[model samples]
Target: MNLKLIKGMRIVAATHNPGKVPEIAALLGEDYEILTAGQLNLPEPDETETTFTGNAMLKARHAAEQSGEVALADDSGMSVAVLDGAPGIFSARWAGPGKDFAVAMKKVEDRLEEIGATDRAAWFTSALAVAWPGGPCVVVEGVVHGRLTFPPRGDRGFGYDPIFIPEGGALTFGEMEPAAKEAISHRTRAFAKLRAALID
Candidate 1:
């Protein structure tokens, strides 16, 4: 868990999502060299775990073992109150094999309407894990309370951003600029905790 010595070492951001790369890099700052799994051409491991922490650790360990370097990974998703967290862990699966967020958004709206539920309460949860080659792993989680919006919103973020409006925020995550969203995002919150742990 002592990551201070790794300040200048190369670390792998164990994810294939391009959108997540910059966000993670921003949080990691310039202290370390960041590389994505895709950049390293590392094969993705199956996310068969049932929880965010489990999946995040799984990915981080996989990347670390493969690259023989410290690796960081995150598992994040939207959980709808009305749906009883239906897509909590399966958020990506909800989009099917093609990863079509558009269809996934529609399904959310349809489910909401079908249930006749007015409460659109939801939250985004992110679990971040860091693993060192043949070493122990650390995991932390953060959540952003919010509500789901019908018809979706802007074209900014990937996944469910178009339909998620944060608490006390007028604009949806999709409508906000990257920096704006990053300021209060679930990932940001998780990264903050992870960063603190590392710095400590």
Candidate 2:
């Protein structure tokens, strides 16, 4: 479907994440005004969809309808090949209600150890959806193959960043600078498709 051209450059982001706002702003360019769902006090919609694309579209449509504005949504997670993608969609939930990645990271490491898994293959997937108040929407998905690192690394980025090392890269996502991470990020890749289809 075609993405409705956003007017007034105002979009309600269907997310409670403050980190995501600036990342999206950078990807979409400075001209667009990105407003977080938290800032707008919009209710965070439940992600009932089985796939990332489904969830992204659900959130985007919910936000667009609730705020009467264009809405953008991202649903992303890390999948471990050895674990059979145990945490694929439950990435955030793995962190528990406290949103503690340290605990989550430990859990991942522990799970790996429990299975005696030597394979470190993993990938991050990001699905993006943009919805207009009128009900039109555009969706895209991106993936970056990588491997998992033990004990996690660095102190930057968020979520499972510390344990993920992109292909041909030595540093984990947490260790890379924002610019470095953004350059090859799953979100950036998804936005690339969105830009080609809508913005470009």
Candidate 3:
């Protein structure tokens, strides 16, 4: 079966994170109907996986099973080199749940300082998985390399956007507009790859 997304396809996304919905919708375009876990009233699955790919696949599989439709899932976060790739999958819980991104950001900054990381080298990674109930599954990934900033900037995106200054750009991801951010975001990169893999 062809894996490419066809127009008017009902795509179930395994996430309640509202911030991600718009981006995903934009990529999938108007031809696809995007449904989130919140809309389905599905219980949030525990991210017990150690890697982003594993977590993404887990969510996608679970959602596809529940909805009996093609489901997409993304697991993404910041990976600090100095931190030994820590806050990788735990980036969300770093704030102690409740989805408090602000707390998480502060914690990241504090940890960076504690480690005396002057370079602040870090990368935001996004792993995407798509699964169809009783069908094969696919996975792809993307990353944007950049350095962390002490004080946050702008207010366009969510999570680690404020501090993530993409390489070669002065402004942080949070400083850029939604459309602009998506153009170079890790998710976009991964989706582009996935699209090519399917369509080409």
TM-score of every candidate relative to the true structure: 0.93, 0.94, 0.92
lDDT of 1 by residue, 40-148 (tens): 9999999999999999999999999999988999999999998998789999889999999998999899999998999999999999999999999999999999998
Q: Estimate the lDDT of model 3.
A: 0.86
Overall local distance difference test of candidate 2: 0.90
Sort every candidate by lDDT, greatest first: 1, 2, 3
User: lDDT scores for all predictions?
Assistant: 0.90, 0.90, 0.86
- Poorly placed runs, candidate 3 (over 4 Å): none
Q: Which digits, one per residue and each the tens of the lDDT, describe model 2 over residues 70-142?
A: 8999999999998998688889999999999888889989999999999999999999999988778899999
lDDT of 2 at 7: 38
In the range 60-81, model 3's lDDT, one tens digit per residue, is 9999998899999999999988
